[model samples]
Target: MATPSSPFSFLDDLFNRIGERLQPPAWAVHEIQHRAVLFLNHVLQQEPEAQQRLLRQQGRVVRFQWRFVTMEMVATPAGLLDLAPAGSVPELTLTVTDESPFELARATLRGGKPSVQIIGDVQLAAEVNWLVDHVRWDVEDDLARLVGDVPAHTIANGARRVVDALRQFVGGRKPPQAGGPSTGSASTAE
Candidate 1:
């Protein structure tokens, strides 16, 4: 049987072309970077261990690069993150190796990390890696503050189901249920 071609195949090329030709205004980029820092800090506040780890690396700037976007941030003495001053040298740099938005989205949906090239201070890189491995935003908890616990739990559960469905679609394999054999792949007889 022939596989069907995607109608949206051209979207990847179209997005790449647009990305190459168009850059976000400096003000917009700056605002976005600030917002990202704020969000990261909020998540960090929920994890005292993460905050303590960040404090250990205080004043070390880390530059993150993905395609044309770059953000430099430094861990504060108070164990929070702040946007580093323009032209401040980074002690460590992490560049995302994936160039395709579609691929990145698929990987994220499948709960996988994007490929990244690390450079500079090994200790700083290790600290950053530890943070990545442990810290996570508790979206459900945040939602519960606004709407109460039961609704938040229901909403989070529904969202998880939707995300799992999307992950299955993107991965081309259904995750095996507890103690069940996976019939996720194409038939062996085929």
Candidate 2:
């Protein structure tokens, strides 16, 4: 017989099946870390490239990457991490730490964007707007919580603005674009 479908029905059945069996939330201080490798898979669908990047197994490790975007997770005592290419090691790196993926994605744009601190000085609060212009995370909800102490709003707005600017830049460039260091594609660590 075909089962009757309702929006809440699946949830009700799920609760009935596992609510009593599930354990309470764990208080483990996970030091999550992982490597985000970049380079288009050529396939519209991408898959994991290595064992070091698996985030859910244990400890404090979480890595994600796609296209030219990449990140490396180094677990901390608290908060979360949003992965993105900031600069380079010899360069710099940008990260967003917040309560959830949604918060990070939203703050990845706008003026008061997260502080892109290079060394103790160089700060790029507006850098997130740059990421958005290049289609960094695909959508707002697709981001991951890399564990850190980051306010949500800044990341959200910064990402939004970056995407807007990137669209304009690409549309105007239309390939065959020649330039210098200031005009080259962003470099990411895999």
Candidate with best lDDT = 1
Query: How does each model score on TM-score?
Result: 0.87, 0.20
Candidate 1 lDDT, 1-190, residue by residue in tens? 6543455457867888898899889999999999999999999999999999999898999999998889999999999999998889999999999877877898899899999999999999999999998999999999999999999999999999899999998889967678687557756773
Q: Which ranges of candidate 2 are over 4 A from the true structure?
A: 1-88, 105-131, 135-190
- Summarize candidate 2's per-residue lDDT along 1-190 as a digit string, tens digits: 8684544556556654564476444332121212222122111122232121222221333333322233444322222233323332322344443323323334543223443333221322122233334323333233333323253445766876667775555345443335634655688899
Candidate 2 Cα deviation (angstroms), residue 62: 17
Q: Rate the local accuracy (lDDT) of all candidates.
A: 0.91, 0.35
Clash counts per candidate, in order, are 0, 41
